[model samples]
Target chain A: MLASLGRGRLLACAALTVLVSGCATPAFDQARALHHAGDSAAGLSVLISAQDTIPERDQLLLLLEQGTLELFDGQSSAAARQFVSAADYIDAEDRISLRDEARALVTSEATTRYTGEYAEQLLAHSHAMLGFLLSGQAESAAVEARRAGKRLREHEDTLDSATFTRALMALSFEMAGQTNDAYVSARALPAGTWPATAARLAQQLGSSDADTLAPSALNNALASARGELVLAVATGQVSTKYSSHLNNGLAWQIAFPAYRPVDAPTPALSLQLANGKTPAHERASTNINQLLRQSLDARAGALLARQSLRLSAKHNLAKELRAKDELGAQLLAIALFVSEVADTRGWYSLPARFDLYRVAVPVGADSLTATVRGKSYTVDLNALDYSRGPVLRLMKF
Target chain B: MFRSLSRSLALAAAFASLALAGCAATTRAIDPGSDIQYDAQYSFSDKNAIVKDLTDSLLNRAAYSADQAPIMVVYDVVNETSEHISTSGITDDIRIALLQSGRYRFISREQRANLKAELQEQGAAAQRVASARKLGAQFILAGSLRSIEKEQPKQWRLNRKKLVYYSLNLEMTDIQTGEIRWADKAEIARESSQPIIGW
Candidate 1:
């Protein structure tokens, strides 16, 4: 009996070692422990060490975890590389467990069916982030965005929600001080594309997700897109709306009058006190024009100083498109509000100038016969125009 | 002994949770409240002729396809915002607006496609890419906005101050010889939450 027991003990020892090393090893536990213990680097190291023992494919989960942590600390480019690499390794159809969990949290009913790509969804998150960043850099960023947009439109059917989001983000970024992200989303937003992200959200808020958006949501989206159309059409700024100087050196030397509210449709919310073109003050060596021209450089410096293009843990807006639960409602509200203005406002006008105009009309029986900058033309209903020299009949209504 | 081990594991898990909690406590969280504090403005699809007029002018700005000479373009822009947004947003927006304008035609993929044939012929294509006499883009225009923070009491809320102010600048540039072709500037300001003084 003692001999048999001894043999059993030896087998048990071997089995235990195999079991620990096979699936959940000591190092794996250590990594999880570190991840929980506020030492992500240590966790990463432990995870990386375990890679030699397991399949490289298994490391995808570990890479994703590490990449997420890296992104939160503002390492977007690095995080992107990690994510792209993981994508290259895995099939697009493989369900991401983490993403699945997030999706589950949003749904109220039992989820019996789910299909699609999580990586693509993550790409949307990335695109939205980049779009948000680009919105802040409306000038230089427009070129690449325009190129990307044209590419996305040609393959729209094949593009997923995330890719669509990227294209839209590009559209949104260009729509500074205006209406929805779609107004100027493309250096070449397509001729007939109508984005429904905001409308979808509004619809989800008011109706069941199983059905299409409520008419109200569609109306809201349509209205927002119209706001974009106003900027595209009225401003005559195909490539540029505001002067560099206007953007910088904004030290308005308005004889500082308390702003008189223009009683218009979208009544001017501006105080009108400091809307002066002249600077309140400037260095003697720098004229206001020169000061303003050089302001983007200063603004760039300030931007660099103030914010880093890192990921956020709590506000994972990039991942929100996949997270079905009206996740970006607040953000969507903010973004939609911004998109409307960016699409309608002239770049040469102040951002607040966008507040003055209430609505625009075709000035004719057809939708295409509107006047801008003094010229008239017929166009499709969905056309977005941001060029110059067309006449716009100023409607004070 | 097993019970004792379970108790120890519970303590370890609690201790682990504490470390994560501590790290998060030190980091500053982005303010989620300020996300929706802005106003909404709108436009209409019911209006079409207006959209056409707006786009046509934009196309006129980008019409660099005269067949007789190359177009020249230079990148110029302004930073008029407190937030680090890209001017490309507006510029690209302008480009799209122009594409739909119908009156103007920019150099298309076909024109660039001829570059290889040009290179096969000699450095002539390279030179054309550099000259306004041979390329597609005539000029590049760009700009930005500047805003300042103003702390004023909220009109609707008690004792709460609102922050506001925004401004803009724009410029056009000649691609060849890098000259400032034309420039313009404008400003707009907004105030949210005026003082409900008596409160």
Candidate 2:
């Protein structure tokens, strides 16, 4: 009887270890470590290999990381493919899982499938469109931009319009000689810090001719006169998982993913226009951390319920075990404690913020230098294959 | 021993109850014209109602439905929606409802091949069909589906709702005069909220 009890305790410990540790793919950590160690090539290899092991639910996350890494490596074609696949996967109804809900209520979010946060979904679509744009496939980029716009309107409720996406679309329309359509797209730009250029483009199109124009309209008209240069900036780490305790009148404290943030270094960019003029860029877009905060707040109540239920179950199970074997009861308590660790599994490769900057360039200016993190990235307008005129440039730093 | 066994039985019963409660599934057939499925980006009932409403507007207009039924061709229904929606399906529904109302004679774009073949096979030299000008559509029905989605401010998981607004705009134009004879729009709004963990 004693031997049997010991075996049960050992099995419980094993189960708890598996439950808590397997929440995140082991390969993700390995790939991240490689990237941090300045071996992105090897990190790419790790992610590629991890595909076979990733569950269908988390496949979107894998694709997102791979796409971003490929973009960083200047393999725009490969990155575009990954982003397209990720976008397609997200569009399909395959991610919805009714079964995971029950498990989530009984255990924690780690037990449920992680169908990425809304921000991540929008960002993935944007990145895919960016890939197509960078690969000089403006037509494909235009289609993706439309799809992303539709998805953003359908899924995200935040006041933020997808400025980067609209900018890409405007550039695409401008290149295709669909200036009217480009003007319409630019006009849709929300009057904000990031969309000032788009508003200005609309004004240049003569859509806003009022003397006392909206600030956005004025900016749009001015930008239309001189060629506009757009810089998309990615900085810092997105949120990371830490434990947040909720006192739900339970015997055990529940540790959920509500803790410390993993911050990435944010760098300011300096632009040197091809016309020998260096202009200071203004912030025109969002950092997307607000989205992360909203997603977490949305999940808080449900997470608390799950945490409370899990603790209550543990308490009951421990009591039951104590009546049978003291050693088994103690082992179960330890197992519960171990399993209570927060599920920090997420797309840790995501940048802390995605911001946009635009500056006016002269007609003769065909290149520019974007300095970020003390390194220079050249935007060669002349070298870029634009069907009409270069309207926007995407650079990763 | 009796008390311990009872305790075990009670625990099992509680678990069984929880399991059964979680497994409860109920379903019923609904009137297709009014049924709304959860997570539907666009509902069939909304489409059906839009078609009926638009058809009514056209029928109410004496200019569109003259003493003799006006000959109208359904030109196109543009899917200006973000998603890949088959606008033709909605147009077909509109066509059927319009025909049943006896408001107009419908010229089929799909049947043009058959019409051409019949016209050619029966021409037989004396028919004088080879040089005849193509019959133009008298009035044309054209429409577009436009959608805008709004999300409520983020709240707790149980309270977050995504609201999608869809507007179906239709117009009948006098092709010869290039003037719109009838125009109408139908609007649908649907709100969806997700459970804590599901997609």
Candidate 3:
């Protein structure tokens, strides 16, 4: 009788563990499906509803998704607010608690919270600052620029240096009429010729005493770049898969995004300027997919350990279930094997690559057409009056 | 044995049901002056410390004494930080502290719009004649809040630390001559660190 009762409790515990296996939640995929179906409003609603269920550690992922949706819908202020919330959450370091760690030991990494990768955290602030800039809040944008700079500096030794963030900071400074600060920021861009161009601009603005402002082709072309043409491309998807490897006599099952192909072709973006000159599309300074892959590789060991813990828990639970009822245990084990999923929660709406093109909007050039995959977006140069300073137009697909 | 097993089953079912039912959250009022949680990149303590330092400097100024109160007007405090912070909250704290000290008199800009409406109404009304006169501020207080963040990456898989520094500068400009009479600065610095994870 005592043995029977013991088996009964074990069965109950097994059932509970099976229920807890759904730690990553299914809302992410549901939202993604909705987004792919062109129902972004529905996708945003799904994410907002899932916010309460997502662990604090993983809440930034949901916030980033919501921000991206808002940005796509042209609600820059709302997008900025959501991204700011995500930045604060990432900075707070309040994702996992002692209770959560204990749960991971009993369950799996699905139960363990997901604090974002360093690259995602930095990108959060970049998107937030961009939203602020689009909404005409220069002071708030400046603040985000500082945060992005600090984040990038932290990852200086890594291949995660974001040159576009530096360029954005320079643009912010130039818009605020701080030519000296702008020059310093522009000089840090990844462009090989920007340093000389920046120095020339500094001298022209009377902020530097450089001897000569040479008339180089790039410098001469950039001199009249009153308006900025931002061309962003969302190419390919970031998907996670469950992988297993043998380590220390145990088969360790882990969930992570697969490595991005190094030889992936860059998507083409065609620009038709009013001056009848088309600028060739350049690759983004930092490839986001490559950066994310590198960041995950750096912490592969830790991630695998967490995944192994969850797999072990599932195994223990299945063994206990088998001891109670053989047939029930067999069915549950099969279900676990089939239903075990990877946590692929990330900002899927973010562009795989963020490309920027400078347009020398000669006076009387009223509009410019940016074509991506046969879809064209027209920018009214007059609407973004460059008399005050250079204006930014974010074109994303 | 059968009876005991039945009783245990009933108890187990009750416990499982209770566990499945999540608890309801409750709300309560908390003291505003209590020590705030140090989780945010920016916290209430940072603002509170800045306010205290700035107010202390103002109180110590030789130009204004406890006996003679100085009349001042506070324009809006500009937030130059990337994070959305309430700059007015800091100014409100300073205003409250100064008013409590009784060494400074403030002309409320919040009342200006209402005052203008009241004067116009008096002009339209035949019976009531309100004066359009207003008190001139002896000094205008305006300032900007700025922040700088620095981070030291994990070295040799040991420690990771992030340092953030904030500077609040307030200048008291004489309204009459436009000469800056007094300037005070409040600075706050914080450092947070975490142990290395992977060996």
* Candidate 1 segments whose C-alpha is farther than 4 A from its true place: A1-75, A78-397, B1-80, B84-87, B102-136, B153-159, B194-199
TM-score of 2: 0.62
What 10-residue stretch in candidate 3 chain A is worst by lDDT? Answer: A243-252
| Whole-model alpha-carbon lDDT for candidate 2 | 0.64
lDDT of 2 by residue, B1-199 (tens): 9999999999999999999999999899877767667684876777787888777777777434435777666644655554446677888887787778776776666564454455434533223122121344566677778776666654555545677888899887676666777888988888886554454
Q: After superposition, how far is residue A245 of candidate 2 from its true place, in Å?
A: 6.6
RMSD (CA, angstroms), candidate 3: 8.3
Local lDDT at A326 for model 3: 78
Residues A242-276 of candidate 2 have per-residue lDDT tens digits of: 66655444447678676255455455677787666
Q: Is the docking of candidate 2 incorrect, acceptable, medium or high quality?
A: incorrect
Alpha carbon lDDT at A187, candidate 2: 57
For B1-199, candidate 1 gives per-residue lDDT tens digits of: 9999999999999999998888774656554323333421111210122223433443445345434333323222344333334444444444455555443344554554564345333433235435433665655445555555544321345443445454445555555655765555443444454333320
DockQ of each: 0.02, 0.11, 0.19
Can you write out model 1's per-residue Cα lDDT over A1-397, one digit (the tens) per residue?
Answer: 2233343353343344333222323554565455444455776666566767743324555455555434433454555455445443442333234443332222210121122123222332333233233233333233233334433443344432222335434433433322223333422223222334333333434535315423443334334333322212111111111211111122111010012223332221111112222111100010112212232332344223222211121124323432443433334323322211111111111111111111222212123343333544443433433232111211110
Native contacts present in each candidate (fraction) = 0.03, 0.20, 0.31
TM-score of chain A of each: 0.26, 0.78, 0.78
Candidate number that wins on DockQ, 1 or 2: 2
Deviation in Å, model 3, residue A231 alpha carbon: 5.9
TM-score of chain B of each: 0.42, 0.72, 0.65
